[model samples]
Every structure is written in C-alpha cells, then in structure tokens.
Target: MTTQTSTQAQVIPKFGEQKKAFSIDKLKRLVNAAKSMSDFDQAKRYLCSYFIPCSNPHGVFMWRSEIKNLEHILDKNISKLICSITKVFYT
Candidate 1:
C-alpha cells in the first residue's frame, strides 16, 4: 500500500505590504521632537511625512489633545479625514 501526503502553500507578503509594528512610545518621542522645533509648519510637514505611508501625504495626529491643534494647522476637512484614518489604524 502507498500513502500520499498533501503540502500546504506558503504565503508571501508583497513588497511594502507588510504591516509595521506600532509603538506608542516611539510616536510620543517623535511628537516631542516635532514640538521642540522652532517652526511649527516645517515641523508639521516633517511629522506628516513620517506618519504617512505609501504615496499620498496624510496627516496623522496621534493624540486626542492634538486634534484641536491640528484643526488650527490643517483645515477641518483634512482634520476629519486624518481623524478617521487614525481611528482605523488604532482601532
């Protein structure tokens, strides 16, 4: 008698498709660093660049306290979009 065994296919993640581990400590550090800078606009641009992944530049304000501040920097529509995106990532 002969027996046959089946092998399962291995899954490979595409390039840049892998999910990065999020660290709140790292985020806090970055936020603090940004805050220390003299130019808020320049700092915000840098922060936004760091936070956004892939192509489009999306502002990611991680803290709740920052929402009001971000509203002042960015328009209400952009803030709302960022808020929604942040919720999806965190939750």
Candidate 2:
C-alpha cells in the first residue's frame, strides 16, 4: 500500500500573479519612512517585513541571490536612495 500526500505542498505563486494589495513600491516607501523615524519598533517592523520570508518571500530570495539580483530590480534612483540611506544609517 502506498500513501501519497500530493496536495499538501504549497505551490509558489506566479511572479506577477500575487495579490494586488502587495505593492513593491509601497514596501520600499514604508522602509524609507521607517528608516527616517526614531522609533526602533516601527523601523524594525518595516525592515523585518521586507527582509523576512513571511511577508516578502521574493525579497528573501533576491537578497540570498546576492547584489546582482537586487541591483537589477532596484534601478538607478532606487540604488541611489539605498546608497544614501545606508550611508546615513550604517556610517
């Protein structure tokens, strides 16, 4: 006798087929606003959501793929913003 659990697996949704409520631009802006604020809890909330697998699954994969994948999605202005923000917070 063979018991197979085929339907138990969660298939990854298509790249563009995720819910409309999930906005990449909104997330980026939230991260920026969070970074500007002085509240640790608020900032942590935004950043953690972006970097964590639960909220931003693609983000975790992109971050894991290294700088190339991230840079490709970031574009010129976003890259600049990231650089500026990092300079402010990291150094």
Candidate 3:
C-alpha cells in the first residue's frame, strides 16, 4: 500500500499596486484576516515600539516587541491584547 500527503498553496494578495501610507488600522485588519486563512503574511512581523512607565523621556529605553504569529493573539483573544499592552511596563 502507498500513502501520500497533499499540500495546498497559499495565495498572497497582490499588494503595492497603489502607493499608500501605512495605517495602523489597516495593518491590524490585514493581520486579523491572515489569521483566519491559516496563512502567513510578512507584514505580520511589524515591530511595536513604546515607552515604558507610561511616561515619555523620563522612561528608560524604548520597549519593543515583535508582532509574531497572529495565532498567538487569536488563541488568547482579548487576554493576549491585555498582555501585549501590559508588556509596555519596564523591568
């Protein structure tokens, strides 16, 4: 007996057709869409930068986190949102 596994290809949207500025709302929407499709979008790798201590220069170095797989967020739902927000805190 022989067995085989089939694979499917993902269709990436044709972006860059029109020049446009990056919008936080748009990025968030696209990332959310990609999550439902079980696909990976390079744009999901954007970095989030914020200052700690809920202050400006008074805070230490800027805190940064890589926006990894949307699955992490999708799995946790709002809990992940809360955690990501709390991560802005300093060590």
Candidate 4:
C-alpha cells in the first residue's frame, strides 16, 4: 500500500499602503475634538506635558490607572494615524 500527503499554501492580506508618521495637523484636529467634548478636562490632563497633582493620594493613584487605560486606547489609534499620514504623503 502507498500513502500520499497534500500540502496547501496559506495566503495573507496586504495593507497595500506604506506606513507613515503622524502629522501635526492630525494631532491638532484630535486635540481640538477632545477639547470640545465634556471629557476635555480629563483628556487635557492625560495629554498634558506637565504632571497634575491629585488632591488626595488615592486620587493620584486613580488618575494613573485611568491614564493607563486611556493610553491603551490611544496607542491603537496612534498606529492608524501614522499609517494614514504615510499613505497621504507617500502615495
């Protein structure tokens, strides 16, 4: 008796566009949108260059936790922003 094995190739999806860095204009638009919303204060604090102190020690810890969560969300968008900028300029 003889046995034969068959193998198949796998296909992957391509982005078709090149990656690029985020632009100042895009960042400005995001900042503007954030400012216009009710969460502006919290967003501003998260984006601020200087650290803001919380009234209570526990408040400070909570702020840090919230910031960390925000960072996780923002990080994903940041990648998309960069890709968009790259496509705009290069393509």
Candidate 5:
C-alpha cells in the first residue's frame, strides 16, 4: 500500500485604496510653472526643492530612461526645464 500527503496555502487580503499626502493640483501647477521658466537657475531651484528622491536605484534608472524615451513628446521649453531640473537634482 502507498500513502500520499497534500499541503494547503494561505491567502492574504488586498489592502484598500491609499490617500495622497500632497496636493496633485498644486503639484501640477508648480511643475507647469517650472516648465515655462526661461532661466535655468529658476527652474533648478524649483525642481531641487520640490522633487524628492526614490529609495530604489532600479526605479530611478527606469524613470530616467522613461524621461529620455519621452523627450520628444515634451515641449522644447519643458525639455530645457527638465534638463535644468535634472542637473540640479541629480548632481
């Protein structure tokens, strides 16, 4: 005679919706304003203060890659703004 064993796994419940701490509208406005700036110094100041760093390197790399890939999609003015922002924040 032969005997067989079986195992069962436990399931976890999914969490509910999360609330954001910052104001999306305000952030959008701020970013839009920064994008419109003609001076690099002004744009750099705004981005350095407003954009926070992520803990993960992979995420950051992906974000940079995405930005590069989408560069053509953004307006020329916005691209200059982003370049200044990146120079300030990444450095």
Candidate 6:
C-alpha cells in the first residue's frame, strides 16, 4: 500500500491588498453624528476631539470605564462607539 501527502501553499496579503477590518471615515461620521446629540456638549467634544487628525494639545485620553458611561448618553447601541474607538486607538 502506498500513501501520498498533499501540501497546500499559504498566501500572504500585500499591504494595499489587505482588507481593512474597519473604516476610519465611517467611524468619523459616526462620531460626528454622536456629536449632534443634544445636552451632552462636553461628552460630544471629548469624543469628537478623540478623532482629530491634527496635533491635539488637549490630548486624546479616555478611560475604558468612561467610555461605558459616555455610551449611555451618546448611543443606544453600546458597541458602536466603544468598538470604533477601541479599534482605531487601541489597535
């Protein structure tokens, strides 16, 4: 009896060819939409500034726990804001 083994080749994706797991523009739009919510100016500003492309003197600093609190005021869907910010900043 003879046994044969088959080998498969692995393919690596190039930088440009790699598919993005998330979209920055989409996240920015979502943040902007969240900013439009009424009665949460401070939270809005904090969240918006987090997305600023230019140098931020104020700095981008937010506690993970704080995100939980802000999510209540900003969005009904908890994961929307959290996931976007986490993916953009943490990753």
TM-score, prediction 4 = 0.20
Q: What is the lDDT, from 0 to 100, of the residue 91 in candidate 6? A: 17
Query: Could you estimate the TM-score for every candidate?
Result: 0.22, 0.24, 0.25, 0.20, 0.22, 0.19
Q: What is the number of residue pairs that collide in model 1? A: 0
- Report the Cα lDDT for candidate 2: 0.34
Which residue pairs clash in candidate 4?
Answer: none
- Rank order by TM-score, top first? 3, 2, 5, 1, 4, 6
Report the C-alpha displacement of residue 37, candidate 1, in angstroms.
7.3
Which regions of candidate 1 fall more than 4 Å away from where they truly are? 1-19, 36-91
Q: Write the residue-wise lDDT of candidate 3 on 1-91 in tens digits.
A: 2111111232223322222333455445434444333322433332222212323323222222333211222332433333331112223
Tens digits of per-residue lDDT for model 6 on 1-91? Answer: 2111110122323222323332446445444443234423433444443332223333223223333221112224335544644212221
lDDT of 1 by residue, 7-85 (tens): 1121222322324433345334334443223423332443443343322233333222323222222333444433321
Name model 5 segments beyond 4 Å from true.
Answer: 1-20, 33-35, 39-51, 54-57, 60-91
TM-score of 2: 0.24
What TM-score would candidate 5 get against the native?
A: 0.22
lDDT of 3: 0.30
**For model 2, how does the per-residue alpha-carbon lDDT over 1-91 read when each residue is reduced to its tens digit?**
2111221122323332333333455444444544334523333443333333323323232232222232223233344333433214653
Best by lDDT: 2
Better candidate by TM-score, 2 or 5: 2
Please report how far candidate 5 places residue 54 from its true position, in Å.
4.5
| Best-fitting candidate, scored by TM-score | 3
